[model samples]
Target chain A: MNSEQQNATLRKMAQLMRDGLKTQTEPFPETEKEFAAILEELRRLDPGDLEGKMVISGFVDHPYGPDRQRCMECMYYLVHRQWCDLPELAVPVEADWWCRLWRI
Target chain B: MANLLWLQGGACSGNTMSFLNAEEPSACDLVTDFGINVLWHPSLGLELGENLQKMLLALTSGQMPLDIFVFEGTVVNAPNGTGEWNRFAGRPMRDWVTDLCKVANFVVAVGDCATWGGIPATAPNPTESEGLQFLKRDHGGYLGKDFKSKAGLPVINIPGCPAHPDWITQIVVAVATGRGGELSLDEFQRPKTFFTSFTQTGCTRNMHFAYKVSATEFGQRKGCLFYDLGCRGPMTHSPCNRILWNRQSSKTRAGMPCMGCTEPEFPFFDLAPGTVFKTQTVMGVPKDMPTGVDKTGYIKLTAAAKAASPRWAEEDIFVV
Candidate 1:
């Protein structure tokens, strides 16, 4: 996508997080089985269902927990693109943003 | 000439297939160049019926010198330890293995099945199968822990789902050529030359690994398979990258995860559903760290590496 379109999407996602749209960010999957379950849940949603994906994945604008982990340290995060690279959740994200899909 | 006897039990013959495909010192080279006498190999032997039994009896009775005894599959001790499941020539193959192990100058166990009981020995183990010298990490197996060949060496294990062809031939040549004394074995009895290096050594993904960039999918040439995929390259001790398969490429080199086939605990996680090809993590951190790395050091290194990763490191590059 063009820079403008990408920026617009990023802004929309940031606004959604700022508005406290309670995402399911707890019980971060502890194993591949649990991780796969989350992926399965995400797969059940319509591809256009951005809100549903966000809620299930537990997205937040700030760092999380005692370790202060965030998208910056996540394996799926693309540093230069400032985006989540997971095929299921291809969305623009802030470096410091936290998500349940986060993995080192 | 070294008289080598090969036998199989509860096996898929994968190692034999690999042996036939040997290139560096091919199967033909073993006979012509290496001076190895083909006493009897399942795939290459010319004996039939009574002749095969005669050859086996001669070896057992000290008429035919058995220089090397290479077993390629699990020694099945099923049916109340009667060895009825897998029969060879005339009697149970397990019995033949027992008799052969006693008289052979050197004993070699090839592939996962013959070395660590492999899939046949997986939980339940209905076949009552066991390796020559080990059942997974445990020491004693079909043979007692103290059991040593006439040459005084325990079973020299060359393990893999299908051991690399060259490893099989090279080790055979070493033993047949009277260099067995020079060969050193690790705890698992694998020759140190082949098992000392990790699979990650010489891996093309080393840059991506050092940078902590994760390869999210198969065939993505850019990142390392460790962080996201279920690659056991870092933890597995095998020269896959060094002695490339087909003399050209390794699993990691071709964008596939190292399945840890060379390690004793292969089919790791007990072949559980959704475990293969998927990295197992706990609280977002990997459960099995690289061989020598601790949790704290791993995390610190990851942070630094990810921060320092160059943009070029994220691009797919064909590895030779």
Candidate 2:
């Protein structure tokens, strides 16, 4: 998909979370093993399953937890492109949005 | 002529191999150009059995002047501290080390084993091995903290898995040419000249590092290895980038992470499961920030660096 398609999918993800989509957000991965487990889960899902990717990754439209971490500060975030550069979760995202995979 | 004796104990003979690959002021240059009389070396020496023992005895007895003593492994005190596990010319290698170190004008510990016990001295050290002057971060190993050579200097540690060839040959030339006293050493006894810089000093991926782009996979041709991959270049002290291995490229340059082999705590985390190539994180932040950086500053820097990152920073811009 092109950049425009990716942006549309990201917007739909935000809408899903806003419309009371209960996602697994608690028990943040505190170790590499935990982090990798989450990635493994995302990897096992169908590549076309954008909603499953968002739900499983615990997408939030704003900064997260006590640290107020966001995609803007994430190592995998591309600021200019407004995209998540993770190979497993290739989706455009807003600067303020966050997910369980969020890492600085 | 300056007499140099090279020996090994509890080692894999890695440093000896690295020494043979020296090219800058080559190994042959040490004898031909630098006027160094190679008294004996584990690989290059011509003596055998009793002949080798006599040479070692001569140096210990002060009958033959010992200019430089180069040890390239650990001092094993295993099998009830008898040191019999690693026997040398006549007795336990440790005994020979004790005698040789006393008379030599300069004592040089080549490679990590001789410098900081390396892998053999890792936790549950079965061989009870130790470096000449240090066991990991501890100051005193087989030698006491106050121990110094005849020249009044502590054991000069040239640390690395095997240490770069030039690092070994260059230091040897300096010592053989009466410049040994001028050489300054860091707290780890590594030459300050080479140990002062980080392995990341000349890394080609600095742009990716500055932009906070993570190189998720190996040999990606772009992105920094410090983020997703466990690269110790920013914290590791070495001239790997500046000196260039094989006179061409370093590990970082060739898309490999700096293993931080030169550091005393190398094979970091005792080769823990899941710690090798993966960056350790806590609460979504790196467990170990670059050398002196704290978490708060890192977050702010990432936010800014990420925001300021150009279009090229996110893509593989290295052209063929």
TM agreement with the true structure for every prediction:
0.98, 0.96
| Model 1 TM-score (2 dp) | 0.98
| CAPRI tier for the interface of model 2 | medium
Clashing pairs in 1: none
**Per-candidate DockQ versus the true complex?**
0.73, 0.77
lDDT of 1 by residue, B1-320 (tens): 99999999989999999999999899999999999998989998999999999999999998989999999999999989989999998999998998999999999999999999998988888999899999989999899789999999999999998999999999999999999988999999999999999999999899988887788887688888998889999999999999989998989988899999887777688888998888899998999999999989988887777788777776777645
Task: Show where candidate 1 strays beyond 4 Å.
Answer: none
Per-prediction CA RMSD (Å): 1.3, 1.6
Candidate 2 residue lDDT tens string, B158-238: 999989999999999999899999999999989999999999999999999998998978879779999988998989999
Q: Is the docking of candidate 1 incorrect, acceptable, medium or high quality?
A: medium
Q: How displaced is residue B123 in candidate 2, in Å?
A: 1.4
